[model samples]
Target chain A: MVSAMICLLKMPCAVVCSKIAKRGGAAWISTLAYSLAVYAGAPDVDQIFSARWAAGIDDGRSQLFELGWRPEARWRFNDGGRLTGRLRLRVQTESGTRPGNIENDSFAPATRPQTIGETGELDLRELYYERPLDDWYLTIGKQQVVWGKADGLKVLDVVNPQSFREFILEDFEQSRIPLWTFNAERSIDDWLGGDWTLQLLWIPDQTYHALPKQNATYAFSSPRLAPQPPPGVSALIRSSEKPDRLFADSDAGMRLSGFVSGWDVSINYLYQYDNRPALHQRFISGATPLVEITPRYHRMHVLGGTFSHAIGDWVIRGELGYFSGRYFLSNASQAQDGVASSPELSVVIGLDWSGVEDMFISVQWFESWLSDYRQGFTRPERDNSLSLLTRRYFWNDTLQAELLWIANTHDNDGLLRPSLSYELEDNLEVRAGLDIFYGKRAGLFGQFDNNDRFYISLRYGL
Target chain B: MKIQQLFGMGVLLMLICEAVWSTPLPDADEIARRINARDEGVAVARSLTMRLTDRRGKTRTRETRAFRKYYGKEKRTVIFYLKPANVRNTAFLTWDYPQADKDDDQWLYLPAMRKVRRISASDRGDYFLGTDLTYEDIKLETRVSMNDYRRKTTGEDEVDGHHCYLLESIPVDEDTARELGYGRVEQCVDSEIWMVRRSRFWDIKGKPLKTSYFRDIRKVQGIWTQHRIEVENHKSGHRTLFLFRDVDYEHGVSDDLFTQNALRRGL
Candidate 1:
């Protein structure tokens, strides 16, 4: 919540100070997108975040919204199947000054007046219609989909990017978008020795679909991702939990993602030449451990492929590719440089262990270098990061022990850091960590003054 | 005799019956009877790691976990997949023996798509990772109710100080193409532990397709567990080896854990 305020206060200020009418539809968009980010995979509880709170060990609106994964029951009398209803309501306050806690629900209005020191809004992340088939299932309306495995910061959750930014900057609170989507999947044949699954996604809205734009700073919208005031400005540190910049010109488009041979791959081609003329040109970013500027982009091509293999307790995984042609980037200004991005390459390699069944741990090293970090094909020498992360799981499915340590550079800077997380329960967790920096992209998270951070979150399935 | 003595005598009856271990060169009748009487039942979770060799035979590995809880009248299972991704999955199934529905309610929660789906009545011969283990293999609705075991051969083996049975037997059922799940299922059981040492399967066309070898057998709560299990897909030329460290059973299972609620709980 504090992070979102920092972002609100730091917003280009132009938008926030603009005549109310000038805000346009962007307001509502960012608003809906704000709080839903917490629940995208609220039920899966795949990583360190959703703990004690989600599994019902604790029941609070924010914790449930962040970690809760509720169920709606169904029974079929005939072959047609049964109808079921599932709904989640999370309550939270905006400015904290808002009385009665009405502003707390996931459905609370984004731009509430006199809300208090709070610069954010309560959100209703997902409310969709679900139609289940024997072998095929569909969820329409507002929903979240994770195309890739590695989540928590959109490194490769290609299917959907729940808004982690709105929580950072109140300006985007109303502009956030949840991809109105339809998903279908079936286990086809096991022809090649591995079970083959065919899945289809129909997105009514692409707000959640990742539409990477270049030249624009990847503002986490929260304190950490957003640029901080030059040291002396304030004594308080600001940061957002998993911040990444995104520009989803959600007119109408769909992305198809799948996997084969240890690699997680996707080919997202959204074109609306007649409507949003600007987005007609494809925009691509190196989608890996979070989007980084990539030299490869084509107004015509957009693609990303990642592969990670765990061989006898050792995992080796990473992604590679290129995009070419006139691509999209920072509101059309940076692209004026003739070439939008560095037209470079990105990759991350990680390894883990499985020798022990009850206990497992993993470490991954990520690298993303732009062949033209200096600019269009100019400087051939490339640069990225060489970071390492570790995650471990404890007994049954209750506790998770995780650590993240990254070494090397982002853009052209050195990053040395560590993140620690302890599983309080299946749905709630408390985390504290820090990043040390020594270069450009080092303003926050890895910025000055130790850059330490602490967070506590809980989830409840409605 | 007092009830206490009767209970103890019943156990003694079972152990003394271990004399059946002596290879009597029993006829098909005696062999079938002896083999079917093995075990206090066990639950298994097998993790299969695949290395897909392309047309050029270059290999790439992907990992997946198959969890199975097998008992008297039924067996329930769930499979979680990782990598070679389109197939990354979570499937729940219950196979009841001597039950009306035959195959229990089955639900698959896919992590990739993030949806739990129900599978209607499916055919048994369906493929299992491109191997002989078919959709029927996962569902134990059909058991060796009636079989004629012809000991084609025997070998001496020891696992954890227990004598093992490595005998070859051909199943009796045929004409089972679309309806039945297994064309043929071969077996090898440990004498003392009663743990299945190895098993093989052939497709309906009578072609050997997949094989599972169990090792590291140990007794847990009066039940035998094979700490290690390996399933090889012959057609795909790939194999998945599962290493089990801590194996516990019937500790405290809340019925709710098996409900649709748990599915959404992402348990």
Candidate 2:
């Protein structure tokens, strides 16, 4: 379907150029050259087909097959300035999994289409234009603005929202949702006597994260009250309202970075609305037993910094962020209760070593702490996690084996992902992997213990 | 009269002994310095194609563009991969200092990550992009330091129909030898051009590791350059052939091309 569309788009342009050439127009050649360059340098299209078959290791009865295909194309304009656009299309079909039961599921209604059955989605990943000035750079349009330099865990990488429909199983690049924004950066090496850069960003659109559907394979199965009451139940229904499309409702941030003494360092600040919604419950009357729940987004201010340095054969990296006025669930018993506000801090430290030939290893530790711990709250005051990644290359680097493990130290829950990938040829690759989860049912990874499965995928680039 | 005759005979014997041992051999340090100074160019740019063949006869070809510039005692080089969709847009940059005591700076840019990462100096011994050449091999031409190695003029030999000087270079210490992954290297340097025509490397265990042959010597912008180079790994039974498609010497290169931003931008 995409090929046909591309042909249709090119036919008219070609005919017009030929006509101009016959009319003896001097500008025809340059015009034709620009068009040809655009065509020749058109971004390569990628098509991936994947199939997953998995069964519960303990029961050996719960089995499922998920088949999917993703096709994406990028078009880069050669109009002198850097301008590019990308279109991605995905289609998936699943067998042997029943439809989700929304009553027991915690996911919002918007995420229902992504969890089961046959579905298709179309997205515009990037549609941006970039220009470099004398000592500054500017970019505008819809794009993904990444921040921080950590792996596995995010400390200050909160510029864009993410999709948890796959429960962190997908690559972060594929999960981060793009936003419409303007970005600029200025070089200050001449003034600062060192290599320094100042960056500013403004996001004008309001976007929310997409969570897993209720009763889905990767969804949380713990008990929870329904977000919306049934019809004719004498209840008040209030949904999370999106911010208005105004400059006052936008988000903004800035970052200053430089390299000093063989170390890369940066400091950043941001003010924005929280991506996740908080629940506020209330009762209208005592005699009628009326219940009301309002979903609202709170404001937050984040201050963060990052640093990386290489020592001997190891590269050490660290990131820290502090969030002020963050909202948390209240421990009050009454239905008419509001979320409490508190300050939170998050930190991550990592090390990468590649001393052995064709082998590389990376380990990271991450933690989060809330200020002024309060008793009886559902959320913990401290959370600690660890992650490890190891990769080995063989057959002249055409084949690679990788193992990834992430464990929550505070909860004793963990996930393991092991994969082997082989490059069949230039622009073509095949990969197979196993995803396993283990721990108590209440833990994060343990909640999806039944979702353990294996998968294989083939990707071909044009 | 008899004492005078004995002193005169001892003086004659001493003079004869001095004359027999006074034919001075070539200084190894001077020879090595001449080899380093032979190819002089302020800047260079070239496009090369590398073909790597394994023991099973499987071949993989890669294309790249490289640029180098000299600023005082510092040399900067940047290389960008141009072919093979998976590896395209990847770049490597290096800044080498003339001072032997200072370590070189190197950075790698990966297009997929959109980030530039610093590479440790200890990892230079690993193979470069699945080729028979290591990072150290590509950097060997610029790292001629007399303090790290001892050079000796062994003999004269003919290489590729040209009479050349046969020289052997060994690490100054055992630790240096182990760190270089090679105990010694033998080179056949052309007498007329002072450029290395062939080189053979031996591992620390005194086993032959690899041999590299340079061919198709030509002058570009008044500098002698080798258009073709071949390296064969004895242990792995793998061979690599580098063919320079285009070469230019003393070309004016912008300093901005050597920065991390240029590496991330690619060619």
- My TM-score estimates for the predictions, one after another, are 0.44, 0.81
Per-residue accuracy of model 2 over A1-462 as CA lDDT, tens digit each: 886787678778677656645544122432344364456566544454555455556666535554545443344445445655544445544422422322112222222123222444434455666777676777786777777777768888888877665667767766777777798888778888777888899987676665545445555442121243334456554655556555887889999888787787889998988766666667566656665756666778999999887676688888899988676665545323545667889999999897877778999999999895565344578989999999998777778999999998987988999999987765677888888988877677877787787767766554
Q: Show pairs that collide, candidate 2.
A: A105-A214
- Candidate 2 residues B92-145, lDDT tens each? 888777787666777888766556777765566667777777766676653355
Q: Which sections of candidate 2 miss by over 4 Å?
A: A1-80, A95-118, A221-239, A279-295, A330-338, B1-26, B38-40, B141-147, B248-251
The CA lDDT at B37 in model 2 is 78
How well does candidate 2 match the true structure in TM-score terms? 0.81
Per-model CA lDDT versus the true structure: 0.39, 0.71
Query: For all the predictions, what are the DockQ values?
Result: 0.04, 0.31
